[model samples]
Target: MNQSPLVIGARSIDVGYFNVKFTLGRPASHGGPAPVGNFPAIAPVLRSGAARHMEGVAQPDGCVVPINGVTYFVGPGAAQRGSGTDARLVKEDYATSDRYLALLRGALWRIAGDAGDAGDAKDVVIRRLGLGLPLNTYFDAAQALRDRAVGEHVVGAGANERRVTVEQARVIVQPQGTIIHFGYTNGGKPLEGVTMVVDPGGGTLDWYLSERTTPYWERSGAYPKAMLACAYAVADRLDPGWRDQPAIVDRIDRAIREQRSSFTVQGQEIQMAEHRPAVEQVLDESIDQMLTAVGKMDDVDHLLFTGGGASVFSARLQKRYPRLKKITRMDVDPIYSNVRGFQVVAEADLASAKGW
Candidate 1:
């Protein structure tokens, strides 16, 4: 309920896992905020089934345990998933990262470096905090190809660098897209009516269209161009000499935060509206590319946008198809819409597996 800010409901979060946003549809009968776990319970739910999966227990639900008078739901997931393995790896890889984060925070506070660290730091945090495996597992796989040295180095001194860049991972279509569509459509039937989804996220721009039967998506149409590009575009237009500045990216972020599309160069206002025709142009082209990808799915009816990007680019969307009746932005951040959508799908999978 980020957008409409809906009250949360029926949530069974892992016992003692804090950081969870639990907003019930109605406040608890006492009408006071529910207390959250303030500290990690050393042995919460220590003997649950999930613990069996993790440290070997008899049940799937982790056993209940108590530490310091705090009841802990030490389940299979926490060790099998949370701090035990995952947190260990993060602590390993980013050994100095908190110090780095503090440094980064200080720099950002001082406006010393780019304020754009949110995206990069997010990426770093995501890679570090991912489940199942550490990031080195991913990066090492890519490095393996370099160690093998495919095709005798096609280019020059920069060739290996280019190769590595090319090998850098990308979002796979099926994994993410399949979940995205299933959010509303169940992934069995094509979304009916003129449908468009604009998913703008920390890393990329996702666009889609579908009308019927087969989910509407154009693999190539899903561009990696992100919202920060818009911010950068605005900056370049305002500062003619910005390319020469080390603080250019930071200043661009600063300008965007300030709400003036352009930056100050020697006290002259640069008309960003005139400068980055490309951001707007890309917006339009992206829509067209989407239509081309989905190819007139005649049954589709709406244009729905989700992602952090949507909040920023809503005006551009309003201009794209002024005629559509339901040109709506998801009531939540687009990035998380797909997440909640996936949660629904995952729950459904669990039910279906149980013969529901």
Candidate 2:
């Protein structure tokens, strides 16, 4: 009798414009929840003595990693060390950029460190890796992204250097991950009828129409009208000079996510409530465009929302479609919905391959 192939490990990475979310699939013997993590999407190259300076300053939420002979500061506090232009927001070729790889390697390094797999100075082998792309980029860039992700990678530098090998990779439309998560967490069954998933993230507003898990590509699409656009609009209203400040934009992004009435900037409190109209206008327009693109959805049984900007877009969406459902998983934040679902999908495939 032939033996089943051994499944080494699996990982899922969702690198959005605002954050990088990831999960590592643990074996059944581990007997605990999946290991997951996230950090800011900023990955700016470190210059000259910056890395040495970073060593002295405490950065609990950030780390430095070397990719192809260049070092980058990646994560929450990374943006503070670089100019605003360092962040490649709204770039059409973002997925193929070095910063994207920096964020990807940063996540892998953290995961390997947390798993204690990097201490042995050996490669951490991932048998399967799952990734996500905006709906608009899925068809055109998915294959290229997958090719870029699979194979050996050296993350970090010097003593912290860790080798990570991705043997296989899978890329799917970003919003589809949310639905997979909803279906798996709800009842371990696939969805039925016409279900629409709207994922509002930092860079793009992606939506998908599916019938019992089969996607309707004609109706599925993505656009650049999302949280970043709202932030820019808010910045324009608050201060024209603030338009070039990525840090200020980050604060605005957080304030919108928290639904805060006001946010403090340079010791001055800026009332977000006053600028609500500007923010809402952008969201409303995006929703209108999405609705028109998807055509009629009267047959839609469930309308779901997921992503970092979900809370910010929820109220507006609910008023438009009363049946809209929010995808919720016990301890998982909405921002992590896609990455978590990607892990679930990869693990399920591994199980099937192993005849489990």
lDDT of 1: 0.35
Off by over 4 Å in 2: 1-8, 27-33, 54-61, 117-122, 320-333
RMSD of each: 18.6, 4.4
Off by over 4 Å in 1: 1-194, 209-214, 217-220, 238-278, 325-329, 345-356
lDDT of 2 by residue, 84-125 (tens): 665437766788878888898888776665654333333577
Return the top candidate by TM-score: 2
* Structure candidate 2, residue pairs in collision: none
**TM, every model:** 0.40, 0.88
Q: Candidate 2 clash total?
A: 0
